[model samples]
Target: MKLSEGVEAAIHCATLLAQLEEGRTMPASALAEYHGLSPSYLLKHLKTLTAARILESVSGPHGGYRLARSADAITLLDVVLAIEGPQPAFRCAEIRQRGPGALEPEVYAAPCNINAAMLRAEQAYRAELRKTRLSDVISDYLGEADPRALAFSCAFVARNQRPQG
Candidate 1:
């Protein structure tokens, strides 16, 4: 299933926000700059995340976005759903029922095997995402990232993050 680029941006932004100190926030522009994404495009996903309570939007000068709850409390699934909506990636059109030599509706009472299989796969995919918390992602990244890259991230966060009053 093809997902939107927004999903990657939102998750990465959320993970980056996890690096912020409590009571601090990172602006959408900063997040876009870090990932080389368009602020306008990233802001749309950020707004959706805020609406989903995965992230909070603070207003005024020195205002920006922060996780609404702890990173451990937010799963990748939450961010994904917030950006992509709760709809399954594969929508079953039941094309099998519309082709020539199609049987009566009663004959197809049971779901199409292909649709059921795809749905099952999607369920497994979502379950895996649900198992992954933002904290886990950040921790894993920190453990394996190159030193220079880590230092750069730390420096950027220090420079761009704002303190909330």
Candidate 2:
């Protein structure tokens, strides 16, 4: 299953927001700048997350965005589903039931094996994502990242992420 660029951006931005102090918010422009993404495009995906209740959008001066719930409460699957929608990646078009090689109608008593296998794989993929959360990923990253660099990033975001004036 190929993930859209929006999914990747949403995940990264959400995890970054998870780094902020409670009640703090980062404007979409700041987040887009941080990741070198287009604010307009990124906001499209962010709206999906907000609509899913995974993130909150604050309005007015100093308005921006923050997690609607704890990072651990939000899984990678949450963000993925928000941005990618609930449609299964591999839809069973029943190709086996069509074309010149199509089997007799009565011969199709069993479920399509290929469809079953693909569905199983998709389940496994989603399960893995659901098992991981933004906080978990951040913790894992902190372990492998340079302490000074992480500190600098945190400080930078905190300093530059003031609610819009």
Candidate 3:
């Protein structure tokens, strides 16, 4: 199943926020420009993150957005659910209950095995996602990059960030 771009954007945004020092903030416009995304759309995703309490928005000349909690406290699943909502990717409509040659009472009364299997698989997928936190992913990203490259990238993001109102 394909996930929405908002999911990816929100995760990236959260990662960026995680990189900031405690009192520092990153504007949504900067995040959009860094990733070549639309500022308006990115703002929407940011709002979702704010509502999820993963990020908090600050107001005034020097205000922007900052992580509400430690990076380790936020999970990939949290960012995903913030943007996509907490709905299952797979849904069972109980197709066996429909059609002229539908299943008999004994069959219809029991939950479809197909639905059960799908649910199990979906649960496993969510469980794996839940195991991943923003800190874990960011640490992996930093570990894979050369020290100089990582420093340059961080500086680039910092330089491009705009002051928020």
Candidate 4:
């Protein structure tokens, strides 16, 4: 199942926010710049993340966003649902009930096997996402990313994050 581009943006921005110390935040513009995304485009997803309580919005000159909770507490599934909504990726249209060979509604009263299988797959997908936390993501990135790339990212965050009152 395909997910929206916003999901990637949200997760990346959230991971950046996780790098901040307590009471610090990064502006949406900085986040957008870091990812080479349009500020408005990234802001839209950031707002959705705010609404989901995965991130908190702080307004004013020194305001931007911070994680609503610690990085370890926010799962990849949380960012995904905040951007993609809670709907299952595969929706069953029940096409099995239509066509010349279609049986009576009563005959098809049992749930379709295809639909059930899709639902099971979706459950497994979501479970995997739920197992991943932002902290885990950061740890993996830090462990595997090139030293120069990691240094650049750390410097950018250092320059952009603002401390809150």
- Candidates ranked, most accurate by lDDT first: 4, 1, 2, 3
Q: Candidate 4 lDDT, tens digit per residue, 1-165? A: 889999999999998888888899999999999999999999999999999999999999999999999999999999999899998998899899899999889988999999999999999999999999999999999999999998998899899999885
For each candidate, C-alpha RMSD in Å?
1.0, 1.8, 2.2, 0.8
lDDT scores of the candidates, listed in order: 0.92, 0.88, 0.82, 0.92
lDDT of 1: 0.92
lDDT of 1 by residue, 1-165 (tens): 888999899889998888899899999999999999999988989999999999999999989999999998999999889988999998889888887988899998987899889999999999999999999999999999999999999999999999876
Q: What TM-score would you give candidate 1 relative to the actual structure?
A: 0.96
lDDT of each residue in 79-103, candidate 3, tens digit only: 8788878888878887777899886
Better of 1 and 3 by TM-score: 1
* Superior by TM-score: candidate 2 or candidate 3: 2
**Model 2 agreement with the true structure over 1-165: per-residue lDDT tens digits:** 699999989988988898877787889998888889999999998899999999999887778999999998999999999988998899987778899988898888889899899989999999999999888998999899998989877886888565444
Best by TM-score: 4
Backbone clashes under 3 angstroms, per model:
0, 0, 0, 0
